[model samples]
Target: MSDATLAIEPSGPKPKPIFSRRNIIVYGSLIVICLYYLVPLYVMVVTSLKGMPEIRLGNIFSPPLEITFQPWVKAWAEACTGLNCDGLSRGFWNSVRILIPSVIVSIIIASVNGYALANWRFKGANIFFTILIFGSFIPYQVMLYPIVIILREIGLYGSLTGLVIVHTIFGMPILTLLFRNYFTSVPEELFKAARIDGAGFWGIYFRIMLPMSLPIFVVAMILQVTGIWNDFLFGVVYTKPDTYPMTVQLNNIVNSVQGVKEYNVNMAATIITGLVPLTVYFISGKLFVRGIAAGAVKG
Candidate 1:
C-alpha cells in the first residue's frame, strides 16, 4: 500500500488560460493608454456635435446632451472666417491638392535616396548622408529664412509647387535613413540574383526591391502623409494665404478674431481637418506596425 501510494499521479494542472494576471495587467495597461490617447478625440467629437449653448453650459469632456450635425454642416459649408464664408471646404481641397503631390514626391525621393545609400555605396555617399541626417536635427526655424530666400530667388516662393518641394527636401533625411537601414536589413542574396539576371540599378530597384519592400513603403507613406498633412510651419511659410494647407487654414478659422467665437463650428472644422490623417493611420494600422518593427530590425 505504501509502494502504491509512492507512485505519484501525473496531473499537471491545466496550462494557464489566456487571461492570467500578466494578461490582465497588459490588457489593462493597454486599455488605459488607449483611453488616454482617445480622450481628446472623444472630447472633440462631443463638442462638435453640440450646439453653442450646450458648449457654454457643459464641460468639454461631457458628452453632448443632444447631438446635432448642424455644426458639421456649418463648418463644412457656411461657417465664416472673416469675409470668407465658404467654410473649411476651400482649405480642405487645397490640402488635398497639396497632400497628394507632397506625399508622392517626398516618398519617391526618400525611397530612392535610401535605396541608393543602402546599396550603391558610392564614394562619399555616407559622408553626404551623414550631413543629411545631421541636417535633420537642425531646427527648421534656423533654415526657414534661407528657404524663403531660396524659394523667392527660384520663383517658387508662396506657391504650392514650392511647398511640395519644401516637403520633399525636409522629408529626405529621415526617409532616406529609413529606406537605407531597411534595405541594409534585406538579404543580399536577392540583390545578387537580380544582378546575375542582368538587372541594372533602376531595374533591380524596380524589379526586386520595390515589390519586396512594401511594408517599408507603407511605413514611409504613413510617415510622409501624416507629417506633410499636418505640417503648419512649412505650409504657412511657403504658401500664399489662399494656398494655405488645411492645417494652416484650420488654425486661421479657429483663432481668427473677426467675430464671436463659435466653439462648435471650430471643433467641427478640427475634426474634419484631422479625418484624412486619421483615416490613413487607421487603414494602415497593421502595415504601420509591421513597418516599424521591420525598420528597427535593420537600423
Candidate 2:
C-alpha cells in the first residue's frame, strides 16, 4: 500500500557536455579571432620594448630579453615626421583639438536632431531623415573634393578648425541616426507625461532623455572618437603638414624614407596612436554593448 502511494519523479533534460561539437566550434572560432588580433598586439608590445639590436635578431613573437622603453620614448618625443623632427606630440595635440570639438558639436547637434525627429513630429521630418540616412551611405571619398572647396571658400582649409568642422559634418548623419533610433525606443508615455508637466524640448531632453541615455551617448562617443582619431584621409587631405593629426604624423613616421627603418619605433608609435580609442572602448565597453542591444531591439 505504501509503495503504491509513492509519486513518480520527473526527469529533467540531460546536461550538455562542456566540449560539445557546437561549443567547440563556437569557442574555437572565437579563440582564432582573438588570437588573430591579440597576436599582432603582442608582437607590437614586445617589439616596442626591445632595443634595435634585439629586435633585429629576435623573432617578433619572442618576449624582450632586455626590456627597454627607448622605442616608445623615441616614438613619442623624437621621431621625424616629414620636415618636423618633433615626434607625435604636436600631432597628438592637434588630434585632441580636433577630437573634442568634433565629438561635442556633432553629438549635441545629432542628439537634438534625433530628439526632434523622434518626439517633436515636425512636418518634413521623414524627408529630412531620409536625406540624412542617405548621406551616411555616401562615400567620404566622393565628397572629399566638395568639402575641400567648401572649406576653402570659407577660408578654413588646412586649419584644425576646418578639420573639426569636417568631422562634425561627417559624423552627424550616422550619429543622428543612432540617437534617433535610441530615442524612438523610449516609451511614448514618458515623453507625453513630460510634455503635460510643462517640459519643453530642451527640458525633456535635459531632464528625461539624457539621464536615461548614458549607454547610447557612450556608444556615440566611442564611435566618434575611434573614427576621428584613426582617420588618415581627412587629416591628410584637409590639413597641412604643420596641422597634421596623429594618424597623419604616424603615417609620416612609419613611411619616412630618410633613415633606416626603425621597426620598434614604428610599432611603438602605432600602439601609442591606438591607445586613446582602445582605452575609451575598454572603459565604456559595457555601456556600448547595452546601447547596441537597446538600439537593435526596435530600430
Candidate 3:
C-alpha cells in the first residue's frame, strides 16, 4: 500500500472530554442539587454561630462575620422552655434513653417476627403478616387514637415505657420487612441442613443466620437510631412533658411562646437535635449500601 494509504485516519469521532458539554451539564445539575440540599445545613451552622442582632441584620445564608459559641452553650444548657430552663441537655438524655430501649426492643421483636415469617410459614401467618404490612401504610393520625386508648388501658399512655412500646410497635413493620428480606436471601440449604442437624427455630437463628446477617442488622440499627432519635410526634403524643424526647423538647424550646424567639439558639438546638441521626448516617454510610442490597440478588 502507498504510504498515504497506510496512514490511519482517526476513528469516527473525537472522544468527548470528561468536562465537555454533556458532562458539564450533568455535573452542573448534580452540583446544584447538592448545594440545594446543603444550603439548609449551611444556613443552620451560620445562624447558630451568629448573634440575634446579626441574625436580624444579616441574611441567613451569610457566614458569621463575628462567630460566637454562645448559641451552642445556650442551646446545650441555658435556653428555656416554659418553667424548665435547663436547656436541651435533659431532652438530649431523655432521647438517649428512649433511643436505646426503643431500638433494642424493636430490633428483637422484628428479628423474631421476621424469622418466623420467612421460615415458619404457618397457615394464618401470611394473613397476619399481610395485615401487619398494610398497617404500616396507615397514617399515624388514623391510628393515633386507637394507640392512645390501648396505651391508656395498659397504664402506659404517658410513660417512657409506653413511649418505648409505641416506638417498637410502629417500628416493627419496616424492621421486619428488612430482616425478612435479608433472611429470605439466605440459602435454603443452610437452613435445611441446620434443621436436619436438629437445630430449632431459635437455634437456627442464633447460630446460622445471625452471623451472616450483620450488614442487615447494622442497616436496621441505623434505621431505628435515626427514626427513634428524630421522632417528635410519637414522643409528644405518647409521653408526658417529663419524658419528652429531644425533638419534642426542641420544639418546646424554639416555639414555646414564653419569650422572644432567639433564632441563634433555635438554630443551635436544631443542629444539636439533628446530630445523633447525622452521626449514625456518617458512621454507617458504607455499610448502608450493603444492607439495602440484602435481598435484591435473591429476589
Candidate 4:
C-alpha cells in the first residue's frame, strides 16, 4: 500500500468507548449502593444535632430549625443511666484503657504468628493454623461461657487484665489470618535471602517482613481497634460496671425497656461511642486502601 494510504488508515477502526452501556449501568448501581449505605449516617448526624423536641417531631430527614447543641452537651455530660446522671464521657476513659493495650498486644502477637506461619515450615504449623481458622468460625457467644469459667478459675475474671486478654484472644485468629495471607503473597525468595545472610527468624520478621507489611499492618490495627472498641457483649459480661467500656455504658443509657426513650441522647451516645472507629477509619482510610492494594499486588 502507498505510504499516504497507510497513514490515512484508522488504527483497527478504534476500540469501542470504555463508557459503554454496561459500564454506565455498573457505575450507576455502585453510586446507588453508596447512597443507601450513607443514608443512615446522614440521619445520625442530623438527628444528633437536633434537640429532643425536634427528634420527637419524627421528621428524621428534616434539618433542625432550632439547631440546638444542648443534646450534644447533655449526651456528653448529663444523660442518666439508671440513677446515675453522668453522661457517656465517664466511660470514654475506660474504653481508652481497654483499647490501647488490646490493640498493641493483639497486633504484636498476630504479626509474629503470621510471620512464623508464612515463612517457617515447622512441624504442625499447618495444623495449628487450621485449628485457628476453625476457631475463628465459632461464635463468640459459644466461647463466652467457657472463657468466663476459665478466667474465673485463673482469678482473672472481672479484671481489666482479664478483659484485655479476652480481646487479644478473640483478635488473634483474624489478625493472624490477615498477616498470614499477606505474608504468603510475598515472594519466598526474600526470606531465603535473609536466611542466607544469617538472619534468624525474629530478625527476618523484624528487619524484613514486618517492614514490608505496613499496609496489612494498618488494616489489622484498624480492624482490631474497631472491634475491641465497639465490643459490648465482652465488656458487659467480662467487665465490672466500674470498668465497662463505653459501649456497655451507651447500651445501659439507651436501652431501658420501662422508660421513654431519649432518642436524641441515644443517637448522640451512639455517635460518641462510634467516634473512635470512625475517626480511625477516617484518618487511616488512605493507608487502609494503600495497604489492601499493596497486599493484593503481592498476592
Q: TM-scores of all models?
A: 0.89, 0.93, 0.92, 0.88
Better of 2 and 3 by lDDT: 2
Q: In model 3, where do residues sit more than 4 Å from their true spots?
A: 1-14, 296-299
Worst 10 residues of 4 by lDDT: 290-299
With candidate 1 superimposed using the best TM-score fit, by how many Å does residue 83's alpha carbon deviate from the native? 3.1
Report the number of the highest-lDDT candidate.
2
Cα RMSD (Å) between model 3 and the true structure? Answer: 3.0
Q: Candidate 3 lDDT, tens digit per residue, 107-143? A: 9889988888888888898898898899789898998
Is 1 or 2 the stronger prediction by TM-score?
2
Which stretches in model 4 have alpha-carbon errors above 4 Å? 1-24, 295-299
1-299: candidate 1 lDDT, tens digit per residue: 55577556546885678999999999999999999999988888899999899888869888889999999998888876556778889888888888889888888888888888888889999799999889889999999999999999999998888998888888888888899999988877777888889999999999888987889999999998889889999988888877888888889889988767888889899999989989999999999889888844431
What are the Cα lDDT values of the candidates? Answer: 0.87, 0.93, 0.88, 0.88
Clashes of each: 0, 0, 0, 0
Compose the digit string of candidate 4's lDDT tens values, residues 128-166. 999999979999889989999999999999988999999
Query: By how many angstroms RMSD does model 1 differ from the true structure?
Result: 3.5
For candidate 4, the per-residue lDDT at 154 reads 100
